[model samples]
Target: MRDSFDPSASEIETTTAEEGKTRKRPRPGERRLQILQVLAEMLQNPKGERVTTAALAAKIQVSEAALYRHFASKAQMFEGLISFIEQTVFGLINQINQKEESGLAQARGILQMLLFFAEKNPGMTRVLLGDALLQEDDRLQERITQVLDRVETSLKQALRIAQTQGGTWANVSQDEVSIRAAMLMSYVLGRWHRFARSGFKKLPTEASDISLRILLSE
Candidate 1:
């Protein structure tokens, strides 16, 4: 049950012999990871400018052609980052669901997990908020939207479960569940937006203890 994703873990190294001298090189598929890591790092820039393939290639000390060899286009690189965000986030959500029997506790765990993840991965926060997807492929934003919808669905399920368990929400209608779920989702998105817009100085988890208590209170 890992709590966060480590971008540095994606790095790989290998040795290659070039004319009798050994040099370090990235193994197959390692360059792709490196590219994503660098892109994420660049997105941490507060300027919020659209990242160009040329800029990405320069950051990694590779020609644009080399990048294309790994990723067909800039969109593909962003897709890679999105894939990482999805896998990490949903994986944790699944863990929270499996370990917690109380729906309210599960909801609290999920919300806290999201904030902690964003606090740790500032660049991924931009991706989750669609800030990094600006001016890029339309499908990228669509994918992010889908991810958010699923998160809201998860929250709804947790709230519904709580209601069924005869707690504060026991008499609540499904519409109420939906509304609460939407509110929770909006809160997370607002925190992420502020964290990114503030140059990552404002952590998503800042004051989360009191906030979560209020949000999850009966």
Candidate 2:
């Protein structure tokens, strides 16, 4: 993936019928995406403060009222970012599960992909760590909890399959697999938290391969 996130032209057109004089106006639904992209970019700042609608509007050269046109409230805007994270990560996870034959390998790849994604998208890492969601609606944090649960479920499935295939942990029961999956989630969360708290200086992937080898080894 590209180092920074940018919306494709097809995804966001510059001209709309409302903005006359043939000037480029944001297309339908494009403004919402532009808003979300700008929000992500602002969150990338390691020392960034709690984002306000006024600041976000200033960044995009729009009035706060204009921002309200696309989203009912700032929390809704954040929900958009969280939704993107869920879709992107889970879609990639599905691919990993489908393509990889070795269950342990699938689990490993999912963890690596999580780190790699955070490394590329520093702003999103803030969201993953709950730094950006501070003081937001309680439900936003709940949504993150759900996302983590889904990740754990995926890990558990891969591990159970691995045991059945006699790759590793062949003698383990479902309960053990569940415990290991929880451990994997904890590992991922810890790495993400460190990355965010260190001003994005400490990478999630630092020493990750060796660590995962030890964690996944039987």
Candidate 3:
């Protein structure tokens, strides 16, 4: 522990010397959230580089061992970010259900939000789109794929909504809706790839409105 900000990790341990009760460690959820928060902060690096465990520990003001106490592996710490992505995007999808009257608009709005979110979170885009998760454990990219699938699913649902409300439901089933959703998702993924490859100096939303006009247009 450092002299000034070296907060004791022992206080939250399982077997305290005095208590000896083996009371369970305080909430794992909170610690997990902190880990994810630190991971997000690490992603904000402008260089678009991979974040290391040592660097992450330094950012959180905790030792790498402390980070391990909460997460078994670096991959696990990334899973926490994956979980946040799922929760956040889906939560917003649920909210879109309440706010938007037309499914087409909901689909459009959701994609817009995803693009905007990625713009704000450069590091997260690397992870979400597999730009950052690549070359690590294979499973990490799979999890990010799941994140994309979830987004595609949400968009498909919105398309289904549009069919019913926007008079675009012309004999479309969920499968057809899913096809269109997947295409839209692929477009966004390509944009993300270009932006990341361009050192993040290239904005993904450049010419976005015209593109969305063509995509969502009849």
Candidate 4:
């Protein structure tokens, strides 16, 4: 449940209270988005500490009850972030699958985008690496694992296509494709860790093209 500037979270309007005082409040859906945005911003910290609902409520300038008005609980807020990641990443994957022809190219593009997206959204990178969900509900971690598994499956599919099309591998079996896809996913995860651990100083895409070339060559 971590990431970047959401344009939609910008200040919308202020409403006058019954006492004739103007108070600022996020517009309807915007509050929910703002809550997620702040949660993500807090998670981007290099410490990778568990964020408590009290702290999250404080960050949003709202009472705990106010926070609950938008989300049932803190876990649900994390789920919101997870849902955002799944939709955003998979939507892009669908496009890559639709437009890309070469299996190798599809795999490469997916990996590159994975790193690029992380590089740009460091907070979300923390969630992707499970650094932000260490102490939260175990289910959040499982959801992240499932997302990565799907990514690996997509990679395996692309690799199998490459093998069928020829010029990608020499008699590589389906098991081997799974293995390599897992390895590629591992590499991406490692890069994400480095990016987060290095206080976001290290870019995930540093020499990424050359690195992918070497890895894919195997």
Taken over the whole model, the C-alpha lDDT of each candidate is 0.87, 0.87, 0.75, 0.86
Evaluated at residue 71, the lDDT of candidate 3 is: 90
- What's the lDDT of the predicted structure labeled candidate 1? 0.87
lDDT of 2: 0.87
Sorted on TM-score, highest at the top, how do the candidates line up?
1, 4, 2, 3
> What TM-score goes with each of the models?
0.92, 0.90, 0.77, 0.91
Clashes of each: 0, 0, 1, 2
| lDDT tens digits by residue: candidate 3, 1-218 | 01111124323456666756665555745565666766776676667678898998887667999889889999888887777677777777777778888877788888777777677667677787776676678999888887788788888888887777645465677677778898899989988888778777788888888888788765
> Per-residue lDDT for 1-218 in model 2, tens only?
33345757324333546655344676787788889999998998888589888999999888999999999999999999998898899989988888899899999999999999999888988887788999999899989888888989999999988998974489888899999999998999899888887888999999999999999998
Give the higher-lDDT candidate: 2 or 3. 2
Candidate closer to the true structure by lDDT (higher is better), 3 or 4: 4
Task: Please give the TM-score that candidate 3 achieves against the real structure.
Answer: 0.77
Whole-model lDDT, model 3: 0.75
* Candidate 4 accuracy as TM-score: 0.91
lDDT of 3 at 95: 78
Cα lDDT for residue 127, candidate 2: 85
lDDT of 1 by residue, 1-218 (tens): 55444567665554556766454777777788888889988888887887899999999989999999999888999999888888888999999999999999999999999999888888888889998898899999999999999999999999989998986779888888899999999999999989988888988989998998898777
In model 1, where do residues sit more than 4 Å from their true spots? 1-25
The regions of model 3 sitting more than 4 angstroms off are 1-34, 166-176
